[model samples]
Target: MSPLRPEELQALLHAAVDDLRPAPDGYERIRAGIDRRRRWRVPAYAAGGAVLAALAALAFFAISPRSHTEVVEPASPVTGQLGSGALAPTASRTASPPVIGPALSPSLSSKGGPTGATATGSATPSTPAPAGSPTVTPTRRAENSSPATVAKDGDIDGDGVVDPDISYNGTALVVTLSHNHQTRAVTLAGVVTPLHYTVTDLDDDGRGEILVEVSGAGGVTTYDVVRLQPDGSLRALSKGPLPLVVGASSSSGAGFSCSGGLVQVRSGTSDDGTTYQVTTTSWRLSGVTFAPVGKATTTSYDTTSSAADPFTARCGTL
Candidate 1:
């Protein structure tokens, strides 16, 4: 372990410097590689930023709520009418109420006029008007005595006798009895035109019932049934629209017929603009009202394509 002098240390350092070597293009090559890497990284970062922005916009729209509007309609009243003499109320006579005495039971007077009947079912016979003293007349009799046009005859009150007669007063249809001379006015509550009328003793009682055919706007047809009361008022037999056959489309129509005291209704409508459906329903009298007794059938046929569908369905025992 001998220590060298200062001159020896200086010569050793000079020798280490002479042993080192340098590459010619070291700095220039490093600078060119860094520039190439930066060019590729800039495009990749730009593309990544664009993708993130698009995802944010799509999520915003997906979570937003949409707006909607709805429409509502008012409830309609129930009323109906029947056209032609075909519609009738046909129930068994067993359903009829007991035979109350005729609605207008009057005793005969000397002049063949009405003799007042008492509340106790007793009649007080009237003699001639005291030998026509002064010949006084009633003003009410003159004003309301415009002879009514008898439209039909029926036992509107179900009183075992068809003593009620229908007539057309200037304002409405009037039902009157000959004995009491009381009048009942009939009107279609929600209907527009009372087009036609007919009467039939469907119940086989001595009294008849009235069926009126009415037409509303948009070619809507309906039927109404009215019963005359002994108390001088008319009552609706059908409290609502009695659907014989309801039209569902502009080109559709309904028809009804009666046979053997049974009513048959036939209707047709286009179901989806491509298929047409026809329905038939049969009804019978139950007690004071009509009920669907037999089977109802609906048959559908395709109109757009050939022979793809001609289906039939039994709508249960309606």
Candidate 2:
């Protein structure tokens, strides 16, 4: 009883109100007030959130850097270790620069000069020249002829000036000589369409003679013996007829033999059978002409025989 329990008093009041009916207008007014307050508070909260979002967006843009469109470059060819991992870089494969130096040729000083060469490698051909050197342009010759080729170079006439000897100029044998400071060239007479020639001393006079193989009128092959004349001209010593030396056999001595101061021609008056009876005739050159020297000799030979041949030897069908 001390303070009459507060709980007892509250229960009494709730019981009294429980039986009483509340006013319907009062409930309706309370509902309307609650609705108005809720509507206003919802709009205020939405507005505050929208402002904060806008401020955040402005701050982010101001602090961030501007974006740029970048360009990419193409990669170069890379060759190196492949299967290990990434590709390895390597040096460029471009060619090296050409070497600049002097080119040596026949008669040409190593300092870049003219040339002379043979296809048989007995001579040297042309090659690329060095810088600042005089260029020697090549010219094409006629199909029927060869270019002026140097066979030997020396004074044949003994006039002092070194002669540039061109043995065969495509069609003929020429000897260019310098006499008394005058230069002269003679294309040997009776010598035509020279194919090639050899320098030899046939007379043993201590002088060289040019033996040329020429094309004859009837397409027959002819040989010419060319000698340097006293008047600085070239003359054919064997203009009459080149020695006939064919059908040569070891069994029979040479059909034609050339010795010091003498030349011989042989023939077999055979009926074109074996065991040819060969006859040899001898002659000597006398002032650019051939003169008979010794008596004619006849000898029998078995063609299968071998002997020391003096010159190109031949007997009819031997």
Candidate 3:
């Protein structure tokens, strides 16, 4: 349809308002409107089809497949809470650093070897681990208290030769010997328990002897001596002149002694019922036996209750 010229539009407007009362500035308003349309409105309406075509082209381009994709990289790991001071995002995977524990010192393993640490992160050998070397410690404490032990290994016989080892483990039934390797022992009968043992050169001889104390009847300790023979065997020495084996020493000082470079035994009695006469008998080593050597007597006469020298001194002069 053809757009109307200014004159035609004016004529139509006048006819429309013919019987209406004109406004004070209504004609001026009409004149201004016509001028505006002549400059802008007429051109816009005439080219309406071109304007619509241009808009359609722009819309097609906007919806077309894009050359590059808008890839939003993932937000970095949040080391801290939202409100907390968060470290700035970084491209590195490790971010800050691994939370490594303090370095630990080498510790002893059960077999007394240094236990080494293992690779953790990425299996790097020297990488500080989340936990360093194990903080384990091996205790070197003795858990069990040992029983009494007796072991003396050297020249055990008077001959200038070393023989089997001799040892007594307190209450054991046998005396442990090293060479025969515990094959020889003093399995004394009627024995309760072994109390103690001694090893020394008993006769001023170059060899050593074993003095064993065995518990006897009524808890009385019987002391016995044994020698290691040159034949690698043991022989119980007949206690020279003393009563069958008993005691380190009698209550009255009657016991065995090698104090004078000779093996001897002492025996004594208060003779009278009231301790008037003290007769002490003595013996010296005779070959492999002990024979009586004479006796010494001590007499107390003044009092009926009686008096006598101590048993130890009874044989002191002899």
Candidate 4:
């Protein structure tokens, strides 16, 4: 083989290139034809899709379960009437009446029957008394009915003695006796002013003494226990001053009285305070002096202060 020259090889390549044809724009042309076909069928494809969706919805509705709905109507006025097509309403029940009998007259009941009156006239009505008629009689109380005398002592003067002064109607009555040495009589009258006195056997000598409360001016009051001497004279066994003082204008004084050998003296104050109260229980025996054994003093004071009013000084036997 001989080595070919450069000119001969170049001529052979040019003749091969000239014999080959161009691709004739085949890929672009095929793409354009495909687009035109799709454009023509787009409406028909859309219509087919809509028909399929409609068929599926119809099938689902035909097979699905359904709920029942009831219709209610308004009640008619003739609902409870017989033969009505609607349901008959219940009827309201009523109660029966109570049994009774004929009333029996009073005159008819007098005859012999169960409702008749008894032979004792039980059915007869009672007659009432007339108005202003007296139903009860006025009782008569006894007059001049004197109180029974318990004990009595005589006092010649208006003193607080059972002998001379008598207590009647809460007042002491003084009795006076006049004698002609043969016959004696007495006159009694309420004492103008009653003075209280106490009698007691203070000395224990079997003889009782009288104690009287006396008040003077300037807050001075005295309790005098006087014993009746055998010589017809009165002697003071004990004398003491009062612990209370009353105003000069006030009608205040001490009162003494004795009963069963016990002596009590009461004193009043001028103002509204505790009235003087003195109680003597026991006494001492001396030749002439009679003293209180036990004495208690109680006083009432004014509302302003605790100061007690002047009262009788309480002292025992010396």
**Steric collisions counted per model:** 8, 5, 1, 21
Least accurate stretch of 10 residues (summed lDDT) in model 4?
92-101
What is candidate 3's lDDT per residue for 1-318, written digit by digit as tens?
999999999999999988797688998999999998889977798699678888899998776644322222222222221122221222212221111212111110111111221111112122343332322111111112111111111224322112223334333234333222334565544332323344444443334455555445542344555655545456666555432333222222233444433444433434333343333444454324556665554433322443432332111111
Candidate lDDT scores, in order, read 0.41, 0.42, 0.37, 0.32
Tens digits of per-residue lDDT for model 2 on 42-99?
8889999999999999998776654322221222222222122321111101110111
Span of ten consecutive residues with least summed lDDT in model 1: 105-114
- Please write out the lDDT profile of model 1 over residues 181-289, one tens digit for every residue: 4566866554323224444433333334455544444555555555443344665566222533333343465555544455566666774655677576766644456
TM-score of 4: 0.24
Off by over 4 Å in 2: 1-164, 177-185, 188-194, 216-221, 238-255, 308-318
Candidate 3's displacement at residue 119, Å, is 54
Predicted candidate 2: what Cα RMSD to the true structure? 32.3
**Model 3 misplaced stretches (Cα beyond 4 Å):** 1-155, 158-183, 217-220, 239-253, 271-282, 293-318
lDDT digits (tens) for residues 1-318 of candidate 4: 999999999998898798888688888889999998899788778989899989999998776543222221221122111111211111100000000111110110111211221211011112332343222211111122211111112111111111211122323222121110111122222211234333334433333343343344465544444444434334444333222222322445444333333344445544544333333233344546434646655444333455533334322110
- Model 1 has an lDDT value of 0.41
